[model samples]
Structure formats: structure tokens, C-alpha cells
Target: MTWADSLRTAWAGMWSSKLRALLTMLGVIIGVAAVITLVAIGNGASQAVASRIETLGTNVLFVTPGPGTPFTTRQVAYIRDNTPVARVVVPLLNSGGQLSVGTSTLPAPVVGTTPGYQALGAIHLAAGRFLAPADITFNRDAVVLGANVSQALFGAGNPVGAHVSLLGQRFTVVGVLQPVGQGPGVSQDNSVFIPLPVAQFLLSTQNLSAVLVGASSPTAASQAQDLLTNLYTNRFGSASSVTVASEDQVLATLSATRATFTNLLAGTALISLVVGGIGIMNIMLVSVTERTREIGVRRAVGAVPEDVVLQFLLEAMVMSLTGGALGVGVGLVLVHLAPLILKTPAVFTPSAVVLAFVFSTLVGLVFGMYPAVKASHLHPIDALRHSG
Candidate 1:
């Protein structure tokens, strides 16, 4: 039989058993869809992290206390004065507890930071103003609320100039930060900001939890990181006293880790494809047995062994390809809509789509081979005598 004739016959056979064909294709559809959706989610998370890092400035480096004691306020001043590339150095004193506004309470990550912390972190006031140098110098009991914190505390009411109790002290809300979504560093939306000295006094410690440093440029940031590392090593008499990292370095590390995790997830999802292939193989084997007499008649008339094999192979591929097409549609929809459900972005790469389709096709070809060969190898007389 001609290839076209074999193709039509294969398609007709599949069409005749529409329900079975659909049932058999379900495996491939599910496998492909799962792989695409998982990969898209992984890619989206990576993108979110990268974008957050970028928004925070690659020229920024986070310096945290590593081993021994935390950095002292004087030590922070010394680093600012000595570090060549360091342009802005902000000391951070964290209050790790809940804040109360009337009867409402929420765990707002309270930070005591310098005036430069606002600009360095791209923080803008939605209402009122940030901590001025006077506030920091005088150690005033003024506080700024993050967007979410303000909403949770005051609902629709403006929080500026309102009082919120923190660590048994009443702090007047001087400002409310603009809504900045969760990002790489501390979440600005769920935090409370106060002057550095007030935070130290309230938290009752002069030791700094961390220091935010901004360099003149990306290159300068790297220089600043190295210089800070060396300076801390000398001052603390050990390399373990401080942890310094530029945003770029952190981004690279995070990207590599995400890539590894993505690969692992994709590999696990691919196992479903293998299972789908096995399903196809088993179903096709049964198909060959059921159609033995039909195959016998074809071969007895004029169909060559290759013709018989091709017919069965075509049927298998068409089913898988159809499944793959459907899977792609379902996956694309999930990628577009899942972000809303997951509250994270979902990025669909062309490479991912192509890979899924190609893998599904390969599955069909690989799994269909055995059944096609078996059907083709059967003698016409034997096949004719065989019952379904």
C-alpha cells in the first residue's frame, strides 16, 4: 500500500475507536502539560528574584554580622569613613516582634535605619515624610509604616501622625511608605521604620544587625565588597566576623541555585512522559492483537511488511501528536492564569514549548516501534487464523 493509503487506514482505525484513542492519549497530554506548567513556574520565580535584585540596585551590598559580636555603631562610622568606594552606609537595628495599633496587632519587621536608607532602598513616602537627619540625630520616637502595615493597622484611615505602640513605647507614625511588593531584601510593605538611635534604644542594644552600603557604581560595589571584607577581617581579627555580598554576587548565586532546582523539578516531571510512553506501548500492543485479522487481509492482498509497520506507527504518532497539541494549549492557559492563583508570575519560554512537543513525538516513535514490528513480523496465514 502507498504511504498515503496506510496513513488514511491508520487514522480511520483510530477514528473508529475514538474513546479508546482519547483515553490512550490522556497520558501524553497530562505528562506534557505537567512539564510545561512546572517549568514555567520555576522560570517565573527566577525572574521575580532577578527583577527584585535589579530594582534594589546592583551597586548595593549587604553587610551583616557573621560570627562574634555584631558591628558597633562606631565601627559603622569607621567603615563609612575608610571605605573608598562606599558612598552611603546605613546602619540597621532590627526589632524582631509585633507592633500594636489600638487593639490590632501584627508582626511588623521593625527597622531602625539612617536617612540614606530610604533613598538607597528606593523607598518613597505615600504619605507624610521619612526619617530626617534631625530625627536620627535626636533619636526621636518617630516611626514610618510600610504600606501593608498601615492598612492592617488603620484600615482605610491615614496613619501619618498616628501613634503605634512598639516594644512598650509609643512611636508616632511620621510617614507611610508607597506600596513596594515583596523583593530581595526586607519586605518594605510589611515593615516599620524608625530612626537608628531610637531603634537601638528601644531594642536596648548598640550592636548592629546589618549595614546597607551603596557604592558609586557596579564596579565600585565589587570593590566596596572586597574592601569591606578585608577591613572586617583586620578589625575583628578573623574572616568570619562579617558577611559582605554585592547584589550581583547574590543574584548569580541565587540564579545558579534556582537553575539546579528547576532542572531537578523538570527531570521529575519528565518521568510522567516515560510513563505515558509505556502506556502508549501497551495500548498499541493490544491494538495490534485486536486487528490481527485485518492486518492479515491487508498483507494477503498486497500490503508489504513495511506498509503494515508504517500504518501502526502512524496511528501511534498521530495520537501522541494530538495529545501533545492539546497539552500545549492547556499548558499555555495554565502559564497565563496560574500566576493569579499562585500569586507569582509564570513565564513561558519558546524552548519549553518546543521541548515538550518534541519529547512527546519521540515518545510516540519510541513506544510505537515494538508494536509496529510485531504486527509486521506476523505471517499472513497465522494472522488470518488468529482470533481477536
Candidate 2:
């Protein structure tokens, strides 16, 4: 049969058994709707998590005791002890350092941190382990190598046990952190870490150039920020140069925008999927009843009942396959447009789109089969005698 003839025959049959077609289509409608909704939501949420990982700073907070102008007015007490919102109070000092091994020496930025810095920033250890309390207690001259530092000084060789002199003091290579993949192009891997006390003595700078504070939750970040502001105002008047940051500030800025776009994606997916399923089901059932007389004619012409069944089954499958192909194109377009609409990354993997396409076809075939079989199994005389 020509393609147009097949489609016309299918459409005519579907029109003949409207209610049966509608009922059969229920499964497809629900299945497609669910697939679209669930998949969009799952993908969107996954992308959000990935973005959060990329932008999330290593031990992010604020630079308390600011360098330029009056950065903050919050007091150390509010950040350290009084506020329930703040989780970790990391006081850091930046200073010049020299990584000298054998005859080669390289300049690196030094960061002084409390123990919480490693965990809060999600630092990964490539070799050796992060500094323990013992290192801090004895003021051990141990160092951790950032990925860049390892590459620069030791090349391909392991630098875990190598000794590097920072400034004028020697620090043993206690650990080397795995690379964070140059994310955001931050030179965190090239930096050196030392205990706060050692950094203080070595850098010859006191009173914490910056303080990094963690929050109890995203919500508490702002409250902590505000409280710190007030405390700093009281302690140092307007002259205190401390910055208070809560993760909540970043989230608050993002939630409204993110939610609206996500909902739009989900809604569009649901609407299209349901519509497509209904269309397939309606077309299938109508095609089946309309072709009943043709089935009787075939049986009378010596075609077996099973042959009739297979013929109708093949027609239903054809319709499903066609609809599935169309749905695939539409779904992909939506997935790609998501990034432009949401202003975030719309990661479209071939696997996910293929899964959705296969799912749509299955939805059509399963839902269309009952009506097709009903038409094929009809008694020849009864089908031929029936009115359209």
C-alpha cells in the first residue's frame, strides 16, 4: 500500500471507533506525560547540581578585614562564636612564598587556614593526607601541593614527600591535593596551604587579612551576614574592613529565576507528551473498527483469522513508529531550547533523547494493540453485516 493509503485507512478506522480509540489511548497519554515530566525534572535538577559544583567556591564566604575601603563592619565575635548561622570561622592570610626544591625555586601564594577549610571546600587529596591537628600543634613545616604546584616544580614525579621552602622556612610536603579541573580558572591548585599560626609568623602579618565563614544552611547565610554587619559596626564603627557572606545570598538570587524556568520546562514537556499520546490512541482505535469490514472480506477470501490479526497489528505498529519518530524530533528541540530559555546549560545527551524516543513508540504500540486485535478477531459475517 502507498503511504498515503495506509495513513488514510488508519485514520478512517480510528474515526469509526472513537470511544474505543480514546480508551486505548489513555495509557499512551499517561505514559508519555509522565516520561516527559519526570525526565525534564530529572535532567534539570541534575544540571543544577553540576552548575552548583562548578561555581561553588572553595571554602566560600567573605573577606572579613577587607583590604579596599570599608569592606565590612562585622566583629570577629559575631562571626566566631555568637552567631548560630556561621559554621566555620576560617581566618586566612595571604603572603608571598617560595617553593624551593634542590636548586629550583618558584613563587606561590600562601593561604593560612583552620582545619575546617579542607572539609568545607571539599578538597580532595591525591597523595598523602590533609594536615592533621598534630601538624598544627607542633607548628610542623609540612606543605600541601596544589595540582599546578606539583606540575610546575616536580613535573611528572610525585612531590608528596618533597621539601619546599616557603619564604625562608622549609615545609615538608605532607600532601598533594587532586586537581579541581581548573574550574572557573581559579588557581587554587597552584596555591600552598599552611597552618594559621605558621602563616602568621612566616608572613609577618597578623590580625587575619580575611575571614571565611561557613553557614549552617543556605538560609542562615544572610542572617549571619547581617549580624556580622551590625557587630562590626559596633566594634570598629564604620572603619572595620570585614566582609560577611552567606551562601543564602547566592541562593536567594537564583531561586526565583531557576524555579520559573524549571516549571516552564516541565509544563511544556507534559503538555506535548499528553497531546501526542491522545492523537495516537484516537487514530489507532478508529482505524481498527473502520477496517472491520475489510477484515471480514479478507476472511471470506480465504485469509486466516491470524493473518487478519497480524495485518491490523502491523498497521498499529506502523502508526506508532511514525508518531515516535515525530515525537523524537520535537523532544530534542525542546531539550535544546531549554538552555536558551533558562539561561543555564541545557545538556542534551544522545542517550537520553534516544530513551525518550523509544519510550514514546512503546507507549503507542502497547496502547494501540487492543483495538487492533479486536478488529482482527471479529467474526466475518458479523463484521461484514455491521453498519459503519
Candidate 3:
């Protein structure tokens, strides 16, 4: 028989037993769909993390006080004065605090920072202006509202000049920050920013929470990190007194972690496909047994053993491929709806779709082989004499 004839025979055989064929394909359908959904979510999460990191810019480094010492605003000044590689150093302090306008009070993160923080942190002004140099130097009670904070305090009205009660003192709103939604490692939408000295007075703590340092360029970030590390070690008498990490270092760590997580998820999902393959093998073996007389008649009418093998193999492939197509359709729909349902990003990758389909076809080929070989090796007279 020609290839087309063999394919036609296979289709006829499967179509004649539609319910059984559909049942046999169920395993492949579920396995492929599961793999696609898991892989898409994994890729989406990794992309989201990478995008959030990119927004922080390339030349930035985050410094936090470590064991054996405490970090303060004076350390920021020292870095600015001594380190030429570090172009800008912005000291930061933050705490969970309450902001009240009128009788309404809401919990928000209060950030104490300098004017250089606006640029170093990639914060933009939606109205009025960011904290000025004068505000820091004169230790003014000026505050900037993040996007969420502004909306909560003033509704649609301009927030620039509005006063909010914080730390038991009234602070004038100098600016409203543009909206930056939830990010991978930071959330600034509901924060309140004040001058470093103002925070020191109100919170009564001189210790800084973190220091943000911006190198002149990406090439200088490593040198700046090393310089700041050495300075902190010399002053505090130990290398563990300060922790410094550039954006590249942080991104590398995040990427490695994300990749490992994705691989684990995809690998686990693949187990279903293996189980599905075994199911297909079991069903095909049963099919060979039931079709014994049919095969005998075909062989008696000049059909070769190769023809029988080809027919059975084609039937298995057709079932798996059909299931794969159905699974792709289902997976794409789920991936599109995942962001709305799960409230997380879901990225559809064509490569993943193609890989899933190919894997399904391979499963069919491997599992169908044993049954096809068994059917082909049967003696014609023996098969014809078997009970129908």
C-alpha cells in the first residue's frame, strides 16, 4: 500500500471506534496542556523579574549595613566625599508608619532620603517638584507623596501643598510621584518621602536603612562597589560590616534562581506525559488483540507485515497529534486568561508550543512500536483461526 493508502486505513480504523480513540487520546491532551501552562507561567515570571530589574538602571548599587556595625547618613557623606568612582550616593531610611489627613489614617512606608534619590531611584514627579537640596540642608518638614498616597489623601485634587500628619508632626506635600506599580523586589506606590534629617528627628534614629549609590556608568559600577566596600571595612574594622551589590550582581542571582525554578516546574509537568505514553502503549496492545481477525484478513489479501506495522503506527501518531493540537488550543486560551485569573504574568512562547507537540509525537512513536511489532509478527493462519 502507498503511504496515503496506509494513512487512510489508519484514519478509518480510528474513526470506526471514535469513543475508544477519544479515550485513548485523553492522556496526551491533559499532559500537553499541563506542560504548556506551567512553562508559560514560568517564562512570564522570569520576564517580569528581568523587566523590574531593568527599570532600576544599570549603574546602581544597593548597600546595607551588616553585622558588627551600623550604617548612618554620615557613611553616605563619606562615600560622596572620598569615592570618585561613585558619582551619586543617596542615603535612605524607611519604616512602616501611618499617614493621616483629617481623621483618616492609612499605613504607608515612610522613606527618608536626599534629593539625589529622585534620580538614583528613577523616580519621576507627577506634579510640583521632588525634594530639593534646600529641603535637606535646612531640615525642612517637606514630604512627597507616592501615586497611591496622593490619590488616597486628595482624590482628584492636586496634592502639591497639601499637608499630611505623620510622625505626630504636619508635613507639607512638596510633590506627587508618578505611579510605579508593584515590582519584583520593591513597591513604592504608597510610600511617603521626607528629608533625612527630618526622619532622624521624628523617628529618633540616626541609622540609615540603606544607601543607594550610582556609578557614573555601568563600567564604573564594579570599581565603585569595591571602593565603597573598602571604605566601609576600613572604618568599621571588618569586611562584613557592609554589604554592597550592583544591579548586575542582583540580576544574576535572580536569573539563576528563576531559571532553576522554571526547570523544576517543567520537569515535574513532564512526568504526566510519560504516564500518558504508558497509557497509549497499554491501549494499543489491547487494540492489537481485538483486531486480530481484521489483520489476518488483510494479510490473506496480499498485505505485507510492513503494511500492518505502518497502519498501526500511523493510527497511534494520528491520535497523539490530534490530542496535541487540541492541547495547544486549550493551553493558549489558559495562558491568555492566566493574568486575569491568577493575577500574574503569563507569556506564550512559540518554542514551547512546538516542543510540546514534537514531544507528543515522539511519545506516540515510542509507545506504538511494541504493539505494531507484535501485530506484524503474528502468523496469518494463527491470527485467522483466533476467536473473533
lDDT score for candidate 2 against the true structure? 0.62
Local lDDT at 279 for model 1:
88
lDDT per residue for candidate 1 within 1-388, as digits (tens), equals 7778878988998899999998898888888888888898888777544543444566788787875666778867787888877888888776555789778887656778888886686788899999999998787899988898899989888988889898888899999988878665335677788898888877778788778788878888888888988988887888767878876676777779788867876777678888888888999999999999998999989889999999999999988888889988888988888866775567787777788899999999999999999999999999999987
Give the per-residue lDDT digits (tens) of candidate 2, residues 250-293. 44534555556555665565555556655665665676577677
Candidate 3 segments exceeding 4 Å error:
55-57, 63-117, 121-211, 215-244
Query: lDDT tens string, model 3, 17-94?
Result: 999888888888877887888888997777654542445577899787875467777888777887788878888886
Candidate 3, run of 10 with poorest lDDT: 47-56
The models' CA-based lDDT, in order, is: 0.82, 0.62, 0.83
Q: Lowest-scoring 10 consecutive residues by lDDT in candidate 1?
A: 47-56
- Candidate 2 shows a clash count of 11
Greater-TM-score candidate between 1 and 2: 1
Report the lDDT of model 1 for residue 374: 98
Residue 147 of model 1, lDDT score: 91
